[model samples]
Target: MIKVYKSDKAPEKLAEAGYTCDEVKQAILNDQKDKCYLCERKVTTDYQVEHIVSRTNNKEKVNEWENLFLACNYCNDRKKHYYDDIPLPNQLEFENVISQTINLKTQKADFRISKINPQLAKLKELLDKLFNGKGICRNLMENRFWNDFMSVYRNFLRRVAAYKIDPTEENKQLVIEELSIEQSALGFKYAFLNKDAELWSEFQDYCKWNK
Candidate 1:
């Protein structure tokens, strides 16, 4: 996950028609770059207006702008109301607080907490489950999740490899663009880049973390 900046002023239609209205969804899609906030997957039609603090848990904030986010069905259904305390992407710089890496040998995602707090702990728990499955059925779903992640990751890796081979300014810019905040699976790409000290130093300054 990455830090997403949302407009504090709620869309007018959100106050009129409700959270599911096109105005509210379009606002969220624009803020989140049409990607699932939790999974970081690029989504078009398959997206939902998710609540940071679920509607069932906090009805008062049901239509609040700060409480709303964009998510894919896979993450929305699995997240439910269970992780209400997880840090909000709009509120925190998740890239600085949490780390997610794919274990090449196992072909699974692993999470590590870079900072500790009650809320951050909950964030870790939620991310762990979202990226790495717990049970049988969820494991099957997670396989597809991992595949989607790898699809973007591999493309990013290819660009990085090209930059490494040529060391040209243009190729370096390509790698930098791929890691921008608006790109899909930014957390994964950032984590992978962190593995290479030289490249990390070269591109770290160019990476956009927050809006």
Candidate 2:
């Protein structure tokens, strides 16, 4: 998940009126880069305009642009009217507070708090509820992770093959660059794979060289 700044084009009164305008929706999509605030999943459809503070908890901020966010239906449903002291992405530095690791064997992403801050802990708890809690949310997330992981893995394998067949300096460099890009695209959730010394030695070597 990432912190998003509200755009100037976002309608301030749209949420107060109990409705989201097209302009507001567009601004939200732009701010969030079409990804869900919690899971960082790319939201193409079945996305919802979420209120940072539930409308049930605070009607006054219902239409406030700063209180708005983008979320997936599964998250929205699981989080329904449950707002209380939850940490909000817009209000916090998400990347600094938490880190995620992906387990290739289980195809599950595990989130860990980077520090012992109270607010960060709360955010972790909320994430656990939405992602690690009961029901099929974890299963759904695992499936999505597998799909994304394989997509990138396939590209990585292809690049590796090209470099192996030629063993040229240029091919080697190209493979390293491709791996870096893939690592970044995987973001916090899946980038943990880069830390696997045995599996990602080549990529890790490139990272160290580049650093």
> Could you say which candidate leads in TM-score?
1
Q: Which stretches of candidate 1 lie over 4 Å from their true place?
A: 136-138
What are the models' TM-scores?
0.93, 0.66
The lDDT of each candidate is 0.83, 0.62
In model 1, what is the error at residue 30, expressed in angstroms? 0.7
Q: Model 1, poorest ten-residue lDDT window?
A: 131-140
Among these predictions, the greatest lDDT belongs to: 1
Error of 2 at 34 (Å): 1.2
Error of 1 at 180 (Å): 2.8
Quote model 2's TM-score. Answer: 0.66
Clashing pairs in 2: 15-63, 16-63
